[model samples]
Target: MTGSDPKADLHRYLQVARAAMLWKLDGLSEYDSRRPLTPTGTNLLGLVKHLASVELGYFGETFGRPSDEPLPWFEDDAEPDADLWATAAESREQIIDLYHRAWAHSDATVEALALDAPGRVPHWPAPRNEVTLHQILVHMIAETHRHAGHADIVRELIDGAAGLRKDNDNMAPGDQERWRNHRDRLERVAQEAGRSAAVLPS
Candidate 1:
C-alpha cells in the first residue's frame, strides 16, 4: 500500500486501537462490562481506566503538560493496581468519558509538539527516562493495542462474540459448527501429543 503522512498514520492506528478497546463493551450490561474475566482481574472498564491513565502520563505529563483532571489512583496512598480497574461506585459512562477526554488532551500534546521534540518520563528509570515525542507516540500505540488484545479475549469470554472490530472483524469465515469441529481436531492432536510426550524419557 502507498504511504501516507506520519502523524496521521500514527493517530489513525491509535484511534483504531482505541475503538477496538471501546467496542469490546458493546451490547454488554453494566455488570458484564466491568466483570473481571481473567485471573489477574482484567476487566473491560478497568482496561479503559488503565489506558486513560497511561495516555495521561505518556502523552501529557511526559511532555511537561499535565492533565487538569485528578487521578486518585495515582495518589501516594492509593492501593496498588488501582488504575487497572474501576470500583463498584464508578459507572461505565464516567470512565468512558474520562478516557475520551484523555484522548483529547493527548491529541493536543501531539499537535503542539514536533515528533522529535524532547520530553522526559519522570516515572521511568533515570538512565532511560529521557525521550522524544515520537518515542512516546510509539510507546502509547503499542501499549494501547496490547490492552486492546486483552479486551478481545476478555470480551470473548464474557460472550461468544470475538473479532478485530465491528466494521472489520478480520476473522476467518466459518460457521459455529465448523469452528467447533476445528477446535475439536486441534484438541485431539494436542491430547495425542501430550500422551506421546508423557511416555517419553524425562
Candidate 2:
C-alpha cells in the first residue's frame, strides 16, 4: 500500500474519465454529436468542449501557466452558457482537437508540479480559492467523472448504447427483451410506490 504512487493513481483515474468522455462521441454523426439532447442543451461535443475549458482553467490558468490558445466563450462578452454547447462553426473535429490539446497541457501541469504545489482558483470565493495540485486533481477527477456520467446518459438517449467504456459496458448482460421487461417491472414498482404514498394519511 505504501509503495503505490498516489499521483499516478489519481492521474490514471482522470485519464480513464477523459477517455470515457471521448468514447461517448464515437460512431456519432456530426448532427448527433452536436445534438442538444437535454432541455438545457447538454450534448456530446459540448461536453468535450466544456471539459477542455475546465482543464485549461484548473490546470493551466489556476497554476499560472495559462493556455496559449484563446477560449472565446469564456470571455466576458460571450453569450451565457456558450461553453456548454458548440456553435455550427465549431466542427466536431475542432472541439475534439481542442480537448486533446487540453489533455496535453493538463498532463504537463500534473507532471511539472508536486502534489503540494500551490495554486489559486480565480473564480472561487474567499480562502477556498487557495488550493494545491492534489486538491485540483481530486476536484478535476470528480468533475470529469460527473460529466462522463452525463455523457453516458446522453449517448444512451441518442442511441441504445450505454456503458462506462467500450471494452466493458459495466452493465448487466441482457438482451433487449430482457431489458424491456426489467424496465416494465421498475415502472410497475414505481407506480405502486406512488399510489401507496398517495393513499397514506397526511
Candidate 3:
C-alpha cells in the first residue's frame, strides 16, 4: 500500500520506526548498547528506553491504561535527562523487551479509546489541564519519529547501517554513500553559515 488511513498511517509509521530502532539494536553486545554515540552520550538502547517510558506516559498513563508496574527509572526526582541513559543493571534484552511490551500496551490503548476521548496530563500545569487523545497521538507520533531519527544515526554509528529501511528496498531509490556525502556537505554549509555573524562578517 502506498499510503494508509490517517490514524493507521500515523500509528503504523510510529510502530515501524520503533521496530527499526529495535532492529538496529539487534546482535549488539550489552556493552555496545550503552556506548555513547556523541559527545553528550546518546546511546542506541537508551533511546529505546526513553521511548518506552514516553509511550507509557502518552498512551498508558494519559488514558488511564493502568500501568501498575513501578517505573524506578522514571523517578521524577532524578536529574534532568538521567532517564536518557541506561544503568549497569539494565541488560540489552530487558530494555528491548520492555519497549516491545510498551508497544503492546500502547497499541491496545490507541485501539480501545476514541480519538476524542478526554485525557489528562498530570505533568501539565494544573491551571489549564486535560487534553484529548488526539492531541497525545499527534505528540507521540512526533516524539517517536524524532527519537527514531536519533536511532537511525546511532545505528549508522554502530555499523554504517543507514535509512529507516534502505536494507528493505521499499522506499525511493538512492545510493547510501551518495546520500551520506550529500547530507555531510549540507551540514558543513549550514554550520559555516550558522557560526557567522548576522552580516556574514567576512
> Between the candidate structures 1 and 2, which one is better when assessed by lDDT?
2
Tens digit of per-residue lDDT, candidate 1, span 139-190: 9899999999999999988887999999999999998898899999999999
Tens-place lDDT per residue, model 2, 1-202, is 4789999999999999999999999999999998998888999999999999989999998999999979999999999989988899999999999999999999999999999999999999979999999999999999999999999999999998899998899999999999999999999999999999999999
Most lDDT-accurate candidate? 2
Model 3: residue 150 alpha-carbon error in angstroms: 1.1
TM-scores of all candidate predictions against the true structure: 0.96, 0.97, 0.79
Q: Scored by CA lDDT, what does every candidate get? A: 0.92, 0.95, 0.80
Q: How many backbone clashes does candidate 1 have?
A: 0
Q: Which runs in model 2 stand beyond 4 Å of their true positions?
A: none
lDDT of 1 at 36: 86
Error of 2 at 15 (Å): 0.4
Candidate 1 residue pairs in backbone clash: none
Residue pairs in clash, model 3: none
lDDT (tens digit, per residue) of candidate 3 on 1-202: 5755666766887777787778778777888878898998989888988988888887877778857655677697777776688888888888888888888888888888877899888888865458887788788878877887787788778876666663583445668887778889999999888777556746
Ten-residue stretch with the least lDDT total in model 2 = 1-10
Mind sharing the TM-score for model 1? 0.96
